[model samples]
Target chain A: MTEWHDAAAADALSDDEVMGLSIAGVPVALFRQEGAFFALHDLCSHGAARLSDGFVENGCVECPLHQGLVDIRSGAPCSAPITEPVRSYPVRVVGDRIEIALNR
Target chain B: MTAMPESEATYVVVGGGQAAAWIARTLRAEGFAGRLVLIGEEPHWPYERPALSKEFLRGTGSVEAITLLGAAQAGEAGIECWLGQRVTAVDRVARVVTTAGGRSVAYDTLFLATGGRARRLPGLDTVPAERVHTLRTLTESERLRGALGGAKHLLVLGGGWIGLEVAATARALGVAVTVVEAAPRLCARTMPPVVSGWLHALHEANGVRVLTGTGVAGVTGTADGIAVTLAGGGRLEADHLLLGIGIEPEVGLAAAMGLALDDGILVDAQGRTSDPRIFAAGDVARHPNAFAGASLRLESWANAQNQAIIAAKAATGGTAVYADIPWFWSDQYGVTVQMLGLPGLGTRAVARGTPEAGSGCWLMLDDTGIVAGAVAVNAARDLRVLRKLLEDGRAPLPDAWTDSATPVQRLPSRPNVGMD
Candidate 1:
């Protein structure tokens, strides 16, 4: 069964912005890029750091801890030192609410 | 020796570290379908050394997690890795490298990424072997981590990056730590005075006793442990001691090969060594940095990766010059310290954030108001913008550079010198 939970308000993040959110004890990073929203595991694959604290540019998020770059849309690591990719969560937007499917 | 015909290009990279791994992968990535072999002295696969002092030592990083290349990746890349094999001699005229195991391999092009080893202090040859430690590889880190797990106190013998990092990790693991430095401040050679003071205070605030301007005169085994005598007539006894002094470049192999050496193997802009068919990179390659006026060796992670790319591309017949400003970072006790560009002597620093607040940025500017470098502590986001500004060789307004209200992204961009 698909489990959907309200993450935040649709307008909480502007274009090219990101924030940290927790869903069911799992840390998640929400990013708004080009009028759409994407979600990824909040933790960096290389170190113990939050992905939301990273810089977002050119459709990728640079890890604050190690400067490892990860593609936001696909959660694939696009740079060296980071071989693993963060898990991506499905996102849905309805009116002013942004929801995420945990798919538990 | 049988003279094998060199039909396919066989590229061999010496040393199994970051530089070796990158060169092997890059050679394949650059469409070199020939044979690639990596020779390493260590038994294990190539792993990151940074985590050894920080996360791995603190029990947070695992052995498998720190590996740079796994079995699957190596197989996929078709790289023949000869781990634990030491390259004793290279027959340059014959284009063959002989290993300690009596095996010889021929290569059309060779890369000397031999890297370096930790420097040892004098008069400590008899300090009860297990009591002294110097971290350089994963095996050394593992031994130190194991020793720290049962040890009560750790005495770090230097105040440099590795010393401070190990001190921080020791503190986190509930081990009493003391950092002793001969200099008056922390990171005296690499960081500015403000940063040094900040780090001294940061270590103090975190319960690690930091002693500056104090040198370890001698070490003797005591009834309890080892007694370390200080220069100023002070004494400290700790269960274990770690020497975190700088490293000595692995130039013996290159020197034996009759390559040019000045502190390190001299390389040109394309990472070519003294010989046209041979190249060097990473800590072992000392080349003239465009930013720094003289030839110097960089042992940072950034240099290992970027320089390997330049050397690999050049070996594969591509023109890639290594001109990027050197950058490095150190993580200690939750604070991430980063430095971009060469903030050497004569560069003035302007502060942007409060050092006492545990977050700050320092813009290193030349006399002509050009951005020469930047150092940031817990300010990685702002560092991204500062790096761009520094690369552009544009100067930020004096007021704006130091103003806390000025977001780095909003800093006015200036026309890059020689670009427009």
Candidate 2:
């Protein structure tokens, strides 16, 4: 836990909340699933739906536009209209904060 | 756990569709000597699906053009046809299936080609009888076909593949079809956004009213027809309502049998599920894919046939896994659309054909630098190569589509039987 830098404070996103941010102008959607923060590319695989506005369940987010699913962990298109994986970022949380690297 | 025929080798096919027909045809082609029994709920010989949403939905489709095999010929092939009888339950343990007519049929090996049912419009109330139509079964299609006048008002619900195909058909028949989909773009649940935009343009050019990001709130039936009220605060008046929304696999019989289901009858690559003997196919069987390492429920005609062949081979003691690259085709507004591999874009994509040009293919690539999947419209020849590349894990140079696309000279014709 000490090796990673803070990407966001704990208050930035609530439980089961997904928020979008940009690091170096690269759009990313951050999801707080099970007290852990994971990030995926903002664009949904099937269409131009924003993943930030989707429903999160069982470690995957369902796209709001057409219900295409993506795994929060691997950023892979889990089901329907999407079979490709979304690019994931290395996110780490420090004391009372969240941090993500822009390497993706 | 396919039962070795006990009583006179009864090969009871529980459903009648292209897959079932292919199983019967392939059995004859492979010189199978089992007594064939085809129990179809539809009361007609199997037909092609290419016409179901397009030509058949309009009034121009003739029955002869769609039916692949005549009943007499099927009879000659020793396939006893049972029409209008739906199988209610399947007792895999007893190796028997019961129909709605209180008839129990024992089988050596049963083929569940039950297929799927068209996803209905939300709320069953207030829908006009002939005005609302779901294009899946021939009975429903024929009804819609007969009711489609030369210039009528049609409101199609959903923006999926089936909805768009019906839209193309209704538009061609000089009918004003307004497709209302809650999704932001058409085919958003299937194709890439680039392709969805192209399809949106295709439907728009053909004079179809495509309203996205809106759901059908309710239906109002009147003397003229039905009026579809949208969630986005608009009303669509229509003489007929054609629903092409989508379909869910008919897993009623399978569910009744208490078999394992991972959204469908879960099966391994060889089509073996929890219960060994009872294998499922067509929109119902969810099989583990070697490439994805996940249980995938593939709902394509190609997958249906491929899985059936694999299931047959496996049943006949051939230990082969069905590992064919999934392929699907759609014809709309006189354009041939072929979808070949699958890829998670932003990883990579090589455009072989310009979808905007109304004809071409796109080669999708994965991080491993291999052809993950490919899609082409009116560029079948290129897709064949792409299919090879994907299945064989071959990656051509990044610019493969520039020199790869060629006019599809011909298509593999479905086998036809002579009337004589």
| Clash totals for all candidate models | 0, 14
Q: How good is model 2 by TM-score?
A: 0.73
Q: lDDT tens digits, residues B1-420, model 1?
A: 123433377889999998888888888878888888999999989877889998888777887887776677889999999999999999899999999999999888999999999988889866788888999999899899999999999999989999999999999999999999999999988876767888899999999999999987899877656789998897999999899888999999999999999999999988999899899999999988876667879999888988988899988778879887778999888887898876544257788886457688887666655566678888887887776666666556656877778778777666423221
Quote the positional error of residue A21 for candidate 2 in Å: 60
Q: Which stretches of candidate 1 lie over 4 Å from their true place?
A: A1-4, B1-7, B344-347, B413-420
lDDT of 2 by residue, B303-331 (tens): 77677667666655568897866678788
Report lDDT (Cα) of residue B417, candidate 2: 16
Q: Judge candidate 1 at residue B392 and give its lDDT.
A: 64
- Pick by DockQ: which candidate is best? 1
The residue pairs found clashing in candidate 1 are none
DockQ of each: 0.58, 0.01
